[model samples]
Target: MPESFPAQTSAEAAAEPTVLARIEGVVGRLTLNRPRAINALDLQMTGLLDDALDAWEHDDAVQVVVLDGAGERGLCAGGDVRSLYDRIVAGHPDETAVFFRAEYALNARLAEYPKPIVALADGITMGGGIGLASHAAIRVVTERSKLAMPETRIGFTPDVGGTWLLAHAPGHLGEYLGVTGTTMDAADAVFCGFADHLVPSDRLDALRAALAAGGDPEATVRGFAQAPGASTVEAARAWVDETFSADTLAEVEERLRAHTDPAASRALQTMGQLAPTGMAVTFEAVRRARALPDLRAALAQEYGLVMWFGRTQPDLVEGIRAQLVDKDRDPHWSPASLDDVDPATITGAFSDEPAVPLWD
Candidate 1:
């Protein structure tokens, strides 16, 4: 956990509502309340958020929805992969499947929300955090913001419409970011279309006050928004494009190995540390997502991919155990290298399955 956020016992955290919703005049304020856990989304939080959104969507009294996190550390870190690992280990895959189903539905709903949604994406936001905030109408980030979709590090590809969002980012930046699990700052986020307005961290309270007082979200955000400094990703666009535009993961690795740029070398090092199978899957998924029509299509495909990985790959559990449980950085991925991953296995992972449907 980050030091900036308050800590809580698991029992205490579980007792509290994962999501807190209050009506402040016409603005509906929804806060992810588990600061101790970095407000990580669990199955229960997914349901609570979805239900709140559903009710607020039809309520005439609600003019806008402001989504934020409770702690100073930032918004959500991601989903509760620890719980997912436990359930899978106990031979209860259905539980994890249900979580993904509800979470994806929430993502889709936010993407199509009728009213404006102002997401205060402060601090560390990654994986499922991106799902929640990136889809919002008005994504507000601060200087403290650190955003990413780092599922590849945990033996999973980015889920919750990440493929759609990343695929549409400038150049092949999505490929580089997704595979490498690189974190980007507020400036990089705004440049890549992940965030809209960049507000200073200290001014967030005032911004929230304005929203609670029935101020227009856009105007208020604009009032507080400032330049996001320099965007490192923008500056490295040519390098990112050239290095990540290869036809396959192997080719991408070769290019990175040959490239003289220190950033490319660092990315290659990061990729080397991640689960090889996960990287291969992410590469193919992003490529496929680039050609997909919309969020729904990308999500549908991602649903199948996750289900397959959960059922067939040991890397998911090993990765989670290494990073979260054992605290050992070394994850013994089953297919330890990209060359060891079978193309047929990759094809099978993406194949259609009886996944919990995203939509009725």
Candidate 2:
């Protein structure tokens, strides 16, 4: 039997559900159905996922869970940043708090879920998408996967437990990816601990069938997942660890410019295009998260930083406008260069607690 809960908030009565949850054999399947937005997680979608998880957790009949996206482009593009930007520009920035709090809470729930959740980290999984997939018990990546925590590009630091994961990545890759917003391929994802297995995109259907047919999730995955080739991240580890380990962003640039590797050159150019405040804050956030006790602590710290960005920083709104809303590729970042960002702003964002609670 199949169960589908169509979203009721839609003006059209016949609109398809943005989230589809059903049972096949002993497996519970959840799909993010908003292909048009590349399955971006909105408030409604988050709530629906939470509800489905609540039901599945207690259902003895449902033994395994599979989460995938509806579209070919990816599992999820990330959170609905444009919607948040719209609310901010409307003079009601506080309204965005509900979405962030709910989303973060949902992420925590996923991290601790009782059942084995097989998350298909295929295609463009970034920002909020990584939160959903990477925390799962069984994370699968494919050759088509393009994974990143690309918040800095839009003048935002990573959230949704992003810092916690970034902090825990191998060597100095966390710091490298955190500031530059670099995308990782399957091998890189596996090497960096973002994914557990690499399964070819063509074999995904067989993989899903094996899961639904009710075998051990791990064993079934082992049968289908092939070993990925050498990670470029691994190849560049000497320069990555050495350059990014510098105490200051200035030194990071100095080291990067000195390296002859084309990877180093590309990274420097990408960093130049990012918002300075975002780079400064994200660099600190990744380092701070590494020192924190756990994911919950990192999430709390990230929540405070997000509130700071929403309420006080001009770069967040400006960056979103240029990148998402206006389609203009240029964002005149506040303090425009890494050298101009105030050190106090970075410290204060991590220190101050938000008025809204993530949990009651």
Candidate 3:
């Protein structure tokens, strides 16, 4: 077990340490240690990370920071949405609001960190995971990497700076993957700009050791990034761009329905399984991010949407039940049809009424 630090407050002990921090050989490493929960960033983890990053920014000895996961399955599956849902059901919606405000602020800080940030995206990285990885200057991926922003599948649009990163993806690929929750390997991730380096999993320990030994971490990472690779996902670029070019989900669906390609058929099926409201919101968010001038503004906008979502929607709880609790692969979305999800509902999610401060 990792050595425990003195608890900041009695309430902190009631929850698990969301993150594990250590400094060795001029490298500051932060591991998302909640393995059983797939290293999801909960409230405590977000606060801990924010403090760690702020400290490291001023510590001259720490030349580089590496973010990794504790377990074999993933770096982070997503944020702890189930916890937020529980808070809502317990009639503490404000707790959910607190969670996003801190989480988004952390995302922004990482994006602008002065010191070099390297992310070891060895396995599953999605939703909140993308927020942590995409902002880093160097993102290393292994063959096991399975990266995505699968929020639409769970009745929520993507948060955690997903709006900005997804918008930065090549062409319409972002729209295709965001709506479909498509998972990709290291090669695909590198192609999509989510990863900068592709290292074999077996080589990670050696890489970490080299960094610890005062090796030029940035140079070492770049060498791996330039290693031989092919863009497998890029081959389907034309189809992805054309099919997702429609103005709305219905138009996109209509085009997909008309296409004869097997890939198009699969895309249609994936969309069919996701919540209509979630998909619509995701589509809009990505487009809006593309036009936004700054990352902070984009994250603030996401916080606005998430604040209302955690309190008002049952999709998050149902999604957690289907994906995590029971693993039943079935979710009963409240507004089952797209028609039931009116423009007003999506508009309401973007309100600034409950003015949440960006950082505490």
For candidate 1, what is the TM-score?
A: 0.95
Better of 2 and 3 by TM-score: 2
In model 2, state the lDDT of residue 243. Answer: 93
Q: Candidate 2 — worst ten consecutive residues by lDDT sum?
A: 1-10
> What does the lDDT read for residue 259 in candidate 3?
89
Residue 353 local lDDT, model 2: 70
Each candidate structure's TM-score, on Cα atoms with residue i matched to residue i, is 0.95, 0.95, 0.90
| lDDT per residue as tens, model 2, 72-147 | 8889888888877888888877788899999898888888999999999889898899989998999999999989
Q: Which 10-residue window of candidate 3 scores lowest in summed lDDT?
A: 1-10
What is the lDDT, from 0 to 100, of the residue 297 in candidate 2?
A: 84
Measured with C-alpha atoms, the lDDT of residue 96 in candidate 2 is 87
Candidate 1 residue-wise lDDT, 233-285, digit = tens: 98889878988999989889899899989988988899888989999999999
Stretches > 4 Å off in candidate 2: 1-14
lDDT of 3: 0.78
- Candidate 3: tens digits of C-alpha lDDT, residues 195-260: 888888888887777777776788977655546377656877888888888887788888888888
